[model samples]
Target: ANTVQVQVILDRSVPDRTALDIYSRPESGGDWTHHATAVLVSDGAEPGGARPSWPPRDADALDVDDVYEALTAAGLHYGPAFRGLRAAWRRGNELFAEVALPEDRHDEAGRFGIHPALLDAAVHLPAWAGLAEVPEGRNRLPFAWSGVRLHASGATHLRVHVVLGEAGSLSLQATDPSGTPVVSIDTLSARLVSSEQLKPAGRGVGDALFRVDWQPLELGPVNRESWAVLGDHGLAEALRGTGVSVSHYPDLTTLTGAVQAGEPTPDLIVLPITTHTGTEAGSGSQQAAQDPG
Candidate 1:
C-alpha cells in the first residue's frame, strides 16, 4: 500500500489558525487506498498576503495532533471510528471539506438509523475550515429541527458536505464512498442557547406499583391527605373537565390484587411521601417513580 497524504487548509479568514496537511500511507500496496480533506473556520476577516508561521520557528510547532486535540477539547467528539479531516479550505462565501466516514456505521436493516441528534453533530465538520481556535466555555444546548431524512440505513463509507446558510442555519448532505447519494438533509438548523430556554412541550404525571412491594401495606387505608393535595393541585378539576377516568386506591393491597388479576392499574397512584420500613421502602419508591401503563 502507498502512503496517503491529508491536508488541512484554513481560509484567509483567521489565517493564523490554519493547520498543516497530514499524510497517511499504507506499508503494503495490495490493500485499498483512501484520501480525505478538511477546512478551518474563524470569526474574523481574512488577512492580506499573510504567511502562516511554519517550520517550528520557536516553542510552538503546530502539528496535526494539536489541531485534533483542540477539536476534542471543544466537545467535538464525533466518535473515534470515523476518520479525521483531510484537507480544509474556505471558498468565497462558504466553507467546505471532504471527510471519510467509517465502513462500520451500517445496521442490520441495511440502513443507518441516523438519529437526528447524530446528524446534527456532523454539521459542525465544516466549521473547521476557518482555523483551529479554542472554543468559548459553554454548556450543552438543545438543537431545533424543521425536517430530517435518512435515505439509507446502512452505508460502509460516506462523504460529508456542509454549507452555512442565512439566519445562522446549516445544511448537510451525506453521500456514499463512491459519490452516490445516501442521504439528503434540508431545512436543517442549529444554535447555541441557554439550558433554561429548553423545556418539555407537554405535561403529565403517573406511577406504577408492583405486587411484591404492595403485599405488606394494611388494607382499607385511605389517603385523604393525598386526595386533598390532588384536589388543590387542580388534577381533579383537570380530570373533571376531560373524559379521562380517575380512580382512588384505599390501600396498597388493592393495587396489588388488581395486578395479580392481570387488570390494568390506574394511571396515577396517590401515596403519602412519608418514609417506609424494610427493603420495600426503597424498592416501592422506585416502582412508584416509574411510568405506569
Candidate 2:
C-alpha cells in the first residue's frame, strides 16, 4: 500500500492509560487487517516490593539442557537470544525461573522493562510447570493477557514467579536481581488446542484459513422517542447535531439511579463499542499462534 494510517488514541477517563492497535489493508482495495494490540498503564506497583527470597531453599533444581530439549520436541524451538530460561524449579503448581538475555543484548535492555525475548522465555516456563491435567500431546496457546504492568525498564537478568490459576489461566511476576518488580501479568490465559488443529495449513484447500469480506450495513433513521448517552458525551454531541436529542450521563449506574429517583426514563441508551472480526469470533480458543522465535 502507498499509505497507511497508524493511530494512537488515549483514554481520557484514566490518566496515564492508553490502548494502541493498527489496521492496514494489503492493497488499497483490500480490507484492513488488524496487526496487533497492546496497552500501557501506570496502575501497577513499583519494584522492591515484598517477594520470596531469590530461589526457594527447598525446591529441586531442573536440568536446563533437558528442559530446552523437551521444549524442542514439543515443537517450541527457542533461538539463542530467546534461550533465557537458565534455571527453573517447581514447588507444587508454582514455578520459579531465572531468565536473562544474552550478554550482547544486555546493553539494549535499558529501553524497556525486560526484553521481549526474555519475557517470552519467562512465560514459557509454565509449560513444564506440571500445571494442567489433560491427555498427552495437547497444545496450549496463549490468547489474551490482562492487567499487564511494566514496573521498571532495563533489566537483563530477572527472577520470575509464576502461579497457575483457575482452569486455564496463570499469572507472572518478574523482578530484577534485587527483587524489584520489572513486569507483572495478572492473568495469562491459554486454551487447550487439538493436535490436528495445530497442523500446518495449505495441506489442501479444505485446511486453509478463511478470508474476511466486509459488507456495508444499511442503517435506518432513528426510531427512538427519547435517548440517553452514557460515559463519553462526544458521541452524544454528534447525534444532537443530526437533530437527535440525547440526554448525557456520566455512566450507566448514575443514569439508572436518576430513573430510580423519579427522573424520566429514556427509550434508548447508547455507548461506543468495538467488536472482533469474524475470524476472531469463530476461532475463539482454537486460534493457532505462530512458532516461538
Candidate 3:
C-alpha cells in the first residue's frame, strides 16, 4: 500500500504570533505522528547595529570589486536590478558580506521592504568562495530556498552571514546596519549548469501567443452611431497579421462577463475607439494609450 499522509495547521490563541504544527501518518485512521513544529521568531537587532562593528574581527577579506564580473563570467548577469554587493569577508567555513543599493535607490529601500537585489547579494558570497577554481565555464543559479523569515522591514544597507550546511547547502542570515535581524533563511542551494543552457531563448515580444477578446466600451448615445462603423474595420484580421490570435466579440461588456457565461476569456481584452476628438496632445487619454499597459 502507498501509505503516506501529512497534515499541517496553524495554532490559534497566540497573541500577535503564529505557530504551525505538522503531523504525518503511515496509514489512514492510524495513529498520527508529530513530524515537526514551526514557530515565528525575531532577532530584534537595532536599526544600525551593522555599521559600528566594521567587518567583524580577524576575517579574511574577499575582493568586492570583481563580484559582478565573476558572476557574469559564470553566466549570471548580476543585472542592475539586483546588483548590491559592497564588501565581503570569510572566516573558516563562515562567510560575511555587506550589501547596499545604489545611491539613487536609497529612498526606495523602505518602500520595497527588503529589496530582492540586496537579498540576492547577501547569498552571492558563496559563489565567491572558490573564485580562482570555479570550473572552466559552467553557470550557476539558486536552486532552492527554505525556512525563510522576514523579522522586520526596510533595510538599505545589510550584513549577511552564510554558513555551510549539510550536503553543501548554505544557511543565510541578513541584518540591518544596527545589527537588527531582517531575514533568516534555513537553506539555500545552487546548481551548476552548462553555459549553453543559460542563453536566452530567441523569442521576440511580438511572437507571444495571446487570446484577445474585443469589447466595446460604453461611449453613451453621442458616439454610439460613430462607434458602429469602427467595429466593422476588420481589426481582428489586422491583429492576426501581427502574430496574435484573437477572438472577436461584438457585444461583450466586461472581461468578467465572459468567464461567468462559460466563454473562454482571452489573455487580452481590447477596447477599440474610433477617434480622439477633443483630446489634447499631452492629455491623460493620449498618455494612457501610449503606455504599454
Highest lDDT model number:
2
Per model, how many backbone clashes are there?
29, 1, 10
Please write out the lDDT profile of model 3 over residues 1-293, one tens digit for every residue: 24568899887567756787888755535556665676654445433323336586888998878777877777776667577887888889888898888878777778876887777778777875644445766745577666777877878888888887654578887888877788888787777776677765323422232445699998765421111111334876777666665665554443345557775545455556545645566423411111111
List the candidates' TM-scores in order. Answer: 0.36, 0.58, 0.51
TM-score: the better of candidates 1 and 3: 3
Query: Per-residue lDDT for 258 in model 3?
Result: 53
Question: For candidate 1, lDDT tens digit of each residue in 1-293?
Answer: 22434434334555545432333333432222233333333334321222222221222211233444544444444454443444333444344344444434334225445533334435545443322222343223224444345556555444555566754465666655555555555555445533233332112421222233344756796543222112123555565456545544445665566556886655555444544578563533422433233
Better of 2 and 3 by lDDT: 2
What lDDT would each prediction earn against the true structure? 0.43, 0.72, 0.67
Flag regions of model 2 displaced more than 4 Å: 1-17, 22-44, 47-49, 130-132, 194-293
Pairs of residues at least 3 apart in sequence or in different chains that clash in candidate 3: 45-180, 47-178, 48-177, 48-178, 49-177, 49-178, 49-179, 50-177, 50-178, 50-179
Tell me model 3's lDDT, rounded to 2 decimals: 0.67
Task: Quantify how close model 2 is to the true structure by its C-alpha RMSD in Å.
Answer: 23.1
